[model samples]
Target: MNFLIADSFTSALARLTGQEQKQTKTAAFDLQLNPAQPGLQMHRLTNSRDPNFWSVRVNQDIRIIVHKTEASFMLAYVDHHDKAYSWADRRRIEAHPRTGAIQIVEVHERIEDTGPLFANLTVEPDAAPAQPASPPIFADLSEDALLDIGTPSDWISDILTWSEERYFQMSDRLPAEVAEALLEYAATGRLRSPELVPANPLEHPDTLRRVQTVATEDELRMALDFPWDKWSVFLHPSQREVVDADFSGPARVTGTAGTGKTIVALHRAARAVREDADARVLLTSFSRPLANALRAKLAILLADDPAKLGRVSIASFEDAASELFQLMTGRRPTFAPDDALQAAVERAIADLGYTDLAPRFVMAEWRQIVDAWNLVDLTSYAGVPRIGRRNRLGSKQREALWPVFEAMRAALAARGLVTRAQLFASVEAEFKAREEKPFTHVIVDEAQDLGVAELGMIGALASGPNALFFAGDLGQRIFQLPFSWLALGVDVRGRSSSLRINYRTSRQIREAADQLLPQKVRDVDGVEDDRTGAQSVFEGPPPTIIECADKADETRKVADYLRSAVEAGISPAEIGVFARSNDYLSRSRAAVAAAGLEGRQLTERAEDFGNCVSIGTMHLAKGLEFKAVVVMACDDEALPLQSRVDEATDEDELKEVFETERHLFYVACTRARDRLHISGVQPVSDFVADMALK
Candidate 1:
């Protein structure tokens, strides 16, 4: 008989202690090896609604809930003896009638009525009697419309009169697709149509998501790991469609923070490797840490087949490009630092007699137009379309500016050092000259942060119709100015999808962090993030915004908060302190020190801090998570950093500065899972004021 492990079992298993978990795994392995062994005691649960439900003895107190039939034995749930029996008693394994998908649903009769809507109310004898409560908002929807979406038959009448609170309490009892649709309808007054009926119930896409047939120990281990990462084992119907889709050209998946954009990208990479025998997949992200996380998750997903895992590669975008550059040039490229490049521009301008123009403006032109598009000569630089450059330049201005850019290019050539953009340009040229590209498919996570030249290099590496796929959130873009992807030959205009379910953050944190942005955020390519439709899976305490009289006062308050959190059972490693720039990290460390705890500075390679609190800039905090986060030193001029604002040469550059700063704050605040603390001096940055935290 086949052995299967359900997500419900893992959810229950995660609660057991180390010893208890180990005993439970031993019981599970035995069951998988031989279900009918006489040494194992299995008793049919008389109180369960489903006849197949049985309880297997794990120890004196712990029990495992198993659903057994002639064909298979499925591990459904596990807990202490009483709780395990109660769980099986309330739930039944069955195939949905209309959608024909297998689901473990709660028995309707087992649920208790939520007594009265309001408690402790008194009615006067003289007052008129209250009318019966009105029907639910969806009462007008036809039964056919409701059933089409997979709503259970027995619960339909209750749903017609159920309040929103009652619905939330019983939502897990319904099929996932139906519950998601009903929640959306309650939040926004619009109902969506249901999916078409599938040809087979057991083989339906939605059914395959929750019900997996495990025939070996490897599959059981995969199921056990699902509670911590449900997205990898169980894909939502919407997310599965995106992963399995066959796109004609480059495609993108966009959503707000916590939505499973990264999940889709990782699964897509795996799917390509599994389906195509000759496919070479490259899974990359914006930073080394995130790419490392991706690699770890990939191992869990593909553990059953090590051969397929060998076919996939994981790396940061820059690392991958640098490796490919070395392969082509036979020498490592020494990139010119930002300051050195700017100095080259200054020296070139002073020597070429264009000292009248602001050095800032000349540098901006070089970055946005000259370097970004790989303009090699004055002729190419003269006609390059400055996509987001607000200042208009006529022929006289172009003629005058070309010489400064050309001079800077010449200076870099003389030093034998190349800029990052120039390096990507060289890599792209090499890819075009080769008969075979390094990767057959390139899946990019955090694609929104890629610069123009990087996108061009990616396009050159995998330019087939189904060669490239990108996943990122537009609101989380902390680096690289906004540029048109279409102009660089990677257009995802018609083939983009947005994920709306947030699995990482709490509702309070998500809402408060959203206040820092407008209702809608759109990239230069006209793709918009559907922020309104996004919702968190859980709720937490609203953030506390602390305003102090001075820096010392703020630091003291922050230290007290940290100590209190630790006293309340949060470990030091679970807490993170961040600032707008490295300039304010000293204050962050001081707060940690005052709290009587050491702070570990988070770096690109250092992720685990053991028992020390992590301190870093907002940029470094990207792709990391914590139980709580403290955004320190939001002083009047620190966040927007007076120097950056003072150096803006035009309206476009200044606008980009503010946008990136706001995104930085949002990213830092959302990294928190439960509590978020935003502290600043009395005259705080304007963004803190916008948070309106209570």
Candidate 2:
């Protein structure tokens, strides 16, 4: 008989104690190995509404509920003996009548209280009489229309009585297609069905998503090992398309905060290496910590195949470029310090007799235009396109600025020091001379944060049609200014996809974070990031925003919240505290210390955060998640720090400063999953009030 495991079983198994889980796993393996063995005590339950329900004894008190048929045995639920029986009695497994997809549905029965029907229900003299129940949200739709989306037969009538809360609570029990469709309708006020419904619903993309068919002992054991991580084993149809699609050139996957972009990048890299014996793939991100996390997930993904694991290399963009530069040049690239570069620019300006030009504007021009494009001569500098740079420089201005940049470049080269951008340029040039690229496929996670030089190098490194893939969210773009990929020769237009289902964050938190951006955010290159239909699968209490009287008051409140989060079962490692800048880093650390939990400052490659709450700047909070998050020290000067604002010399620079600051807040706040507590001193940043309204 076929052995099927449902998401419900995995979730229940995750809650079992360590010893109980071990015993239950052994029982599960035995059942899969030989279901008819007499030593395995399986009892048919007469109390269950479905005749197929049976309980398998795991221990003296634990029971495994199984729905058995002649052709298949489904491990449906698990709990203590009585609770397991009660769960089985309240549910029945069957193939949906119209869609033909299998579903385990709650039995439809009404319990009548023996006590007088209205016995404790006294009506107040001023109260009106009770009204009849309301109908389902989509009651006007035809039965065929409903069934085509895989709505269960038994749930049809009861759906008419389900309130919004009830519908949300019961969503996990419904077929994924049905739940997703209903959620989409609820979110957009429009009912949408698939363009082509599958004839065999059991084999439909939606049906096979969360339910896996375990055919071997090893497969079952692997599934049990990571019981709660179903996303690792099963890919959503939306995610699978991005992972498996072939592109003529570079391609990208974009979504909001928690939409599984990283997972797709990891799986795409794995698949490329697995399918081609000679293929080498690089799975990369912008930061070392995030790259490490991706490596860990990739290890789990390729654990069964050593060859695939060996074929994939993982690194951050900086590390990858540095290694390539060192490999070709026989020396690591050293970067000139920012102070030295600025001083060089000062001397260059003095030598060029451009005293009228503002030093800030000249520096911006050097960094964003001349240095970014590696313009070697005055003519190229005068003609280079200033994409996102705000201050427009005429030919005279460019002529005056080019010499300063030239002198600065000469100074840095004289010291044998190169900026990261220069290193990337060197690496790209070295790879261009080779016939074969370093890696056959390159998958970039958190691609939104990559700089222009890094993008140019990545584009140069991938020489094949299906070599480049990126996964990121435009709403989380904080570090880099907007630029056209077409100009860089890495255009993802017509090859872009968006994921709508958010898996890492709760509905309340996602919604609040999303309000920071427009419904549709477009890049300067005209790539539209449409987030209209995105929805979270889970719900939680809305994030709490409090404005305290002072720093001490905010710290006290934040500490209390942190302690409460721990009391509510969030481990210290699962909590993160953040501030807008390093100015407030001490305050965050103090709050964590006051709460009696050790706090560890986060770094680019910090993995040893043992039993301590993480404290870091908002910039470092990217690509991380927490059960609870505290974003404190939101005084106006702290967030959107006055220094960045003061440094803006043009309209575009000011706008960029404000937008990136808001994105910073969005990234930090959305890192929370179940609970979020944002505290600040009175006169909190305007962004805090905006989030409160959301």
Show where candidate 2 strays beyond 4 Å. 1-4, 16-46, 51-75, 80-82, 94-102, 108-122, 125-136, 160-166, 187-208, 213-221, 228-233, 350-359, 433-435, 606-612
TM-score for candidate 1: 0.86
Candidate 1, residue 388: the lDDT equals 67
Q: Residues 1-694, candidate 2: write the lDDT tens digits.
A: 7788877788788767779989999999999988888887999999889999999999999999988899888899999988999999889887776666677777766554677767888756747766766546765656677777778766677665666677777776666667777776676776665435467545655556556578888889877876545335556657887888989988999999988898899889889988899998888888888888888778778867877888888998889998888889889988888998889888888888878867888888778877787778998887777766776778886776677788889989999989888888888888877888998998999999988888989987877878999998888888888877888888888999999888788888988888788889987678889999899887888999999998788878898999999888777888999998887899998899889999999988757787789999998999888889999998888778889999987888889889999989999998898899998887888888888554
Best by TM-score: 2
* 438 Cα displacement, candidate 1 (Å): 3.4
lDDT to native, each model: 0.82, 0.83
The 10-residue segment with the lowest total lDDT in model 2: 227-236
The candidate scoring highest on lDDT is: 2
- For residues 561-632, what per-residue lDDT tens digits would candidate 1 score against the true structure? 999989876778889999988888998999999999989998878365767999999988887778889999
Question: What C-alpha root-mean-square deviation, in Å, does candidate 1 show against the real structure?
Answer: 4.1
Itemize residue pairs with steric clashes in candidate 2.
Answer: none
TM-score for each of the candidates: 0.86, 0.88
Give me the displacement of residue 351 in model 2, in angstroms: 4.7
